[model samples]
Target chain A: MHTSGSRIVRVGTSLAVPVRRRALVQGLAVVAALVAVGIATLTLGGLGIAPERLPAALIDIPGGSEGFVLKRLRGPRFVVAVATGAALGISGALFQTVTRNPLGSPDVIGLTAGAGAGAAAASLLLPGAVSVPAGAMLGAAGATVVVFVSTGRGFSSPSRLIIAGIGVSAMAVAFTQYVVMLQSRDQAAVLHAYLTGSLSARSWQNAAVIGGALAVLLPAAIALGRRLHLIEMGDELADALGGKAEQTRVWSIVVAIALSAAAVSVAGPIAFVSLTAPQITKRLSRTPGANVVLSALTGAFILAAADLCAQQVPVVEDLPVGVLTAGIGGLYLGYLLVREWKKGTV
Target chain B: MLVGSVLLLGAAVLAGLALGSNPIPLPEVIAALSGGGDAYTRTVVESRIPRTLQGLLVGACLALSGVLVQGITRNPLGDPGLLGVNIGASASVVTATAFFGLGGHATIWAALPGAFLAVGVVSLIGSGRGGATPVRLVLAGAVVSAVLSAYIQAMTLSLPDVFGSYRYWVVGSLAGGDTDTLLGVLPFAVAGLVLAVLMAAPLNALALGDTTAATLGANTTAIRIGGMLSATLLCAAATASAGPIAFIGLAVPHIVRALVGNDHRWQVPLGLVLGPVLLLTADVLGRVIARPQEIMVGVVTAFVGAPALLLAVRRMRAGT
Candidate 1:
């Protein structure tokens, strides 16, 4: 989806600047990229629109195309795509950094799997929380707790953490499938979209849920992410520098969970953005901070762009946005694997 | 261990045969198996045995494929299904069914060719000088899988009747028509198993990384081609027999690795044994728990594998 052959985004560079400044620059650049892409998404939709009138249409300046199409249709979808992309991308980055494994992200870390499990249970078994975000959160919390409990000794090594995450995520997948099988065949399609990830038939109501969740969660990640900066310096060093190793980890994880849950609830577990965005941001920033803000902006840009591409092929009526991203996510994962292979390192 | 696994498999197969929307007893099952019972015996023999065989073959294939793939990639963790073998097979079947208007045995035939094509495309795109480098293979597979899966989704949505009917098969299952599928694909399964076994020696050598393996007189090219051929054959045969059953590749190999460590020779065999054991057990549990309404085996396996994967990740973190 990213046309990797022609243009590989220049991310990793050893720019000579203070780590903090580098991150700020990267954040601004990614924001600029996202803004352009977001507008492009609004321009390219089901119905045709005149680019000259794009600004007028956006502001609803007296009969520019259709009011409902601009405000209600494309506007909400663009918002959801941007929000979901950013949330998933940063979430992936956070998990990868904390785990220290490139493969470690919300999807691989069991966050999405756990949330999917919860969503499936709500829809199939309970049905009360079928459309409720809280049910998904509850499920994610349970899975995260289980994941954290298993890693109680310490969360220093990235590889080990990912291995543990796989185990937890596998169970969630199984449980979700089990529930789907028990339900009538008619219900399986809806259940499957949650597991595989999708953003079809999204509306203002859906956007509100996602937007509302993001409002609470993104700020928390930003605040707690500062503490994570210290923790990443190594556990012993962090403790020596007056950081409470255990409490800080707990808080970061809580933040990670909030971000992951909100992302899953809104976007239905878009893949690898969370895992790849932060790494890309870090490379662009050349910093130790892991650039959460840059990750969010970059993620938003990626999703909005992908969403634009998806809308082009109206063959499926509603192309799954996650499917589009997963395509790229898989490629990015492969790229990491290739790098690891080439270096003879994992 | 083999005996225990076989017993568990037998018990699971019997339970699957006996338990369904309609229930039958132990005696009735015996009579049915011996060809002296009522319509139930014929049904069990014709339906259950083939279904069980499909499970057995696919499970063994997946477990073995997982071992082969992990060996080739040199990653303790690699999923053949994740590598898009299943996606390839599924996309092929969907094309045949929804687009080409194929069904029944014809659909199965279409699936085999489709599976082969998918495997061919993925391998061709993924393989390189380093003997199918793990990352390239993964990325290539990811692309192929996504493209094929997108086609599937598009087709399914368009052809509501075919796609709607294909729902059971899509999610992965072993409860559908068994006899024709079993008979049609048994040769492929047997051939695949033999091919996998044959790959043991070169794969063992390949485990020492490509350079050392080459230094040790291993034919890198032959080993890679053989390993890939076997993996594709196993997956294609298994998918043709049952629809693409998910996660056996991921879970069985992980369990086998835990039991036998990283030796492909030992790991492959262990995976073969344990894969059947796990699938059968899951099948049995599905039968018993759901009872009059049996849960699909694929769904059950996901339930079992997902948490186990999570647990493994958590433990690794703790150790780190």
Candidate 2:
């Protein structure tokens, strides 16, 4: 039942399960990196917290400047970044699995663009009628449907899906620009910052929403991962292997879309993390069947690290985290493309 | 067909002049153009002249560049904006303005080399062992554009002064074009156009695949390199003058192809004439669409062009 690189562990004959050694090791390493990033994020900033006092700051609500800085400012932003990043990671893994293409992450497939358009319209057009997050979720769902329908052959044709997504993204972006044009220059600037995905001034509610989304969808994503792997073997082969391929694909897409929408709603369509996280996780673990948990951990680490850099980098300090991710993750994607093309794998 | 396109271009130019937030009558527009209008009408007409010229130049450059790109790459979806050229120009302009303190016309020069660099990288990355396929080129373009956009965004966000001007420019508009910008980019546009027209016949040879093209006495390597260089120049010039307008380069070539069949000769000239027509029409539409508010031409073009892009994607055979 297990592949060459993985070993089966058995407590008894009936309880055998295959585990990938490298994936386990790399997953732990990613977790450790996440812890380090979290600590750095918590400690190093304009208000420097001593490493030893970080634990007490996390636990207590002392009525002082230190407490306010930790409990109010950095804490929630950190939580949102981690949770949003993890959601994006899991969402990306699901998308890559369902489409059978590494480049089919939600951001690349128009989910973020739709969410951005929705958020822009809701915030500007309706004003107080609907919350930005709710608008974003609606937009993401709408975009998913449009892309699916536009693909003509569904997820079976990954290329058409990606191209159709690009077309959808173009329209969505144009709509957002039209909305931005309606505002005054200063208002447009503020909207521009928000559209690029800023984490500045995030509250606890943002963290809670993304956290809840991850909690609700993470299990579904994991449960569907095995089936998605089967689906990648083609619909007939998957069905012959006793898996309902199309059903599994649809369900995986639903979970992925929900997770991505949740992240976009809170973070305003942060770029590139979703596209890169799963690929990075796959490369690191070297075991290739939708390493969902490891991908989530890797994503959390990347966003946390990116946010920390955004805060700490002097000349470019306080940059929207999305811009930073686009710079780094885009370069990484470019490298991946070059390498993939060189190997004739693309 | 070329004469009809030219006539259409004339009509578009007239419409662009006559229509705007402050709509001037056709007679007034003609009088103003001939330096015989009232002071207020003269000022309005004079201000719009640079914008119109920019629209025309940018449109022509983008269209010719699109023709060259599509012909050279043998890709139906080839476009300067889609191939990272516009963003390359934009990132260059931002860098020159922010880091080097280059302003106004100087950044136009900076944009050309930046565009060249970007197109060079994209072609290198895209070609691989099998030459540049549509999917690979498009993906490379997307990734390079993302990286460059991030750089531009970072620079603009960090520097408020750059942000003030960069925001409007990034959205792709003709509103900010002045006589100096039009003059600055005109030479580059003219040179790129000449190169493109000259390369069109070779591109036809290239359409038959490299080996066959070489045996037919066409230097495929020279054609590709010259065509790319021409495209970069056109893209840089257009982006410099009009701030990276999309879809003109993408949609114009396809429209020309539909009209003129597969001959690069007819496609190039037709695209040259029709490019400005499409751009001027989009620009005019933008002026009228939001009234005094003024939607940028880039926004209008994107709205108009997305459907065309979708159509192109749909027509593409599977496996690309």
Q: What's candidate 1's DockQ score?
A: 0.29
| Model 1 stretches with alpha carbons more than 4 Å out | A1-30, A43-71, A126-137, A149-254, A275-291, A310-317, A327-346, B1-47, B219-222, B304-320
TM-score versus the correct structure, for each prediction: 0.80, 0.81
How big is the RMSD of model 1?
Answer: 6.2
TM-score of 2: 0.81
Interface RMSD of 1: 4.7
How well is each residue in B122-168 modelled by candidate 2, as lDDT tens digits?
88887777666555676677678778888887776667777766666
Per-residue CA lDDT of model 1 for A239-326, tens digit only, reads 8987666676655555666777777777676665675577556555555654667778878877887777677756433667666675
lDDT of each: 0.69, 0.81
lDDT of model 1 at residue B134? 63
Which residue pairs come into collision in candidate 2? none
lDDT of 1 by residue, B142-228 (tens): 556666765676565546666555675766677774677778887887888898888887888887877898899988878877887
